[model samples]
Target: MNKIIYIGMDVHSSNFTLCSFEPGYGMSEDKIFGQVQFKDDLIKNTAKYICNLKSQRKDIDIVCGYEAGCLGYVPYRELTRSGINCKIIAPSTMAVQKGGKKLKK
Candidate 1:
């Protein structure tokens, strides 16, 4: 199977922070990709970022995700419509791995 670029985002009304990880890139956690403003070109800008990454690493595919919040499902719907693979994870349902920092001794 092809390597997957996993993008996780921390979104807000004014802007958002994106982080990316290559599952096969060792045990390191996700790293910051960049931040983007929430504006008229949000969708276009976000898509372009992913496209740029793909351009650099043609061997990988992108799969992004973020917790649902005040903005509702509009972003999810729009991104999917634009051919981006995204998933909405609920905060309550999100969990850290057993050995992750938060759950460690």
Candidate 2:
């Protein structure tokens, strides 16, 4: 059976903040990849990171996603070109928690 590594990205004009979640049935843990400086080949580097994870765990598949804004389709195109499954989520369609949105550690 293939396990999934779901990656969520908070992309900005100058950097990208990535977090990977591995669902352990009902006990999941999230691993933060931290902020990677934005550059011409940043998307390629992101793909390479995903590839590395795949290499370490052959039974896993990665799915990356980011909000649909600012940078536009470039990320989606690059990730797909690198053969990783990627999704672009609309901001309005996102489900918010009871407290709305908050920054907490």
Candidate 3:
């Protein structure tokens, strides 16, 4: 089976930046997925994209999370229903700084 990877996403109104991480190794290249509208092809295409990344494995486990924002829980609900482990995190609750010059996530 292909190894399960942890996915971290930087969510925005128009698009998403995703980074993949293996258990023992570091994160892979960042991938950007555009969202023309909520609850559309983006969900399906994202699932497909992840599958492609772990295609060689018999199965994969994906745990994903994004900062909770104006989009609400719709995106999280949709993704979990599709069998992906997803979480919505409050941005202010985290230590990530947005306004500072040296931004960190």
Candidate 4:
């Protein structure tokens, strides 16, 4: 069976991007599920997207990651409260290089 994962995000005021990485699938196969300008009124839509992914991929773990931004942790808290696993990534620590780059351990 093919397993799928969900990466929910509450982006900065500028833009939002969602990247989904499937196990056994290479980086080239990583899919950008969504990318668009952020809208404070769309919080409900964001929550719904996460919930839908959770429902569709019961066999796979739903791990979420979003850059730490001015929005704070309200979205993360909401996701966790709904039983989804999540992490707030430090954008400053994300490596920009491909090879020989080590991410935070």
Candidate 5:
């Protein structure tokens, strides 16, 4: 059986950027999925996208991370309810340097 892991997502009010990483498969190492834009509200669109990605990748474990922002907890709730594991990260967590901008401790 082929095992795939890790999915990174960059989300905004208008669109979502997705990148999938697989350890064992060379073919999936550099694969880039198309970006999806949502015309509806952020919460609804995020829920829809999570559901769709879960359905599409049933065999693989799907882990998603998005920056913590004004969108609130709706996205996290929706993703969890849809059975996709997600983490709400601070923008600073993705910073290249150790001390760029600090979020409240």
Candidate 6:
């Protein structure tokens, strides 16, 4: 069976927090895969974790996105080379909650 897992990443200078969501009939269910910490190879470590996730599952496709800023296109290139679809989002255009909800820590 083919399944799609939506992944959102919170990226910082030295670490990245990766979370995964599965589409539900009435709502969306989510899981925190984990955080990747790196001193010099942030994108490489992140891509390794993503590939690890893919290898652990069968027939599941991943679509990952991160805000466009300091990181730039490095992430897009590495993730795409690993065969995962990636999106670099503009922070100004991303949707947010009406109330104070923490999207990233």
Using TM-score, give the best candidate's number: 2
**Each candidate: RMSD:** 4.7, 3.2, 5.2, 4.8, 5.1, 3.1
- C-alpha lDDT (0 to 100) for residue 1 of candidate 1: 63
Model 1 score (lDDT): 0.71
Residue pairs of candidate 3 with colliding backbone atoms:
1-58, 2-57
Highest-scoring model, lDDT: 2
Cα lDDT tens digits, model 6, 39-89, are 667788778877888899888888889888887888889889878799988
lDDT tens digits, residues 34-101, model 1? 44544546656677777788789778778888788887887688778878899898776766677653
Q: Considering summed lDDT, which 10 consecutive residues are worst modelled in model 6?
A: 29-38
Give the C-alpha miss distance for residue 12 in model 6, angstroms. Answer: 1.9
TM-score: model 3 vs. ground truth: 0.63
Give candidate 5's TM-score. 0.61
Q: Give candidate 3 regions above 4 Å deviation.
A: 1-4, 25-40, 97-105
Question: Could you give candidate 5's per-residue lDDT for residues 1-105 as a string of tens digits?
Answer: 534445566666666655555564555445445455555665566567656766786786666777788666767887787677888887766646476664321
TM-score of each: 0.73, 0.80, 0.63, 0.63, 0.61, 0.75
lDDT of each: 0.71, 0.78, 0.64, 0.64, 0.63, 0.76
User: lDDT, candidate 3, residue 43?
Assistant: 64
Candidate 1 segments exceeding 4 Å error:
25-40, 96-105
- 48: Cα error in model 3, Å: 1.9
- Write the candidate numbers in order of decreasing lDDT: 2, 6, 1, 4, 3, 5
TM-score of candidate 4 to 2 decimals: 0.63
Candidate 5 stretches with Cα past 4 Å from truth are 5-7, 13-28, 97-105
For model 6, the stretches where C-alpha displacement exceeds 4 angstroms are 27-40, 99-105
Candidate 4 residue lDDT tens string, 47-93:
56667766776776667788787878876787677776778888787
Regarding lDDT, does 3 or 6 come out ahead? 6
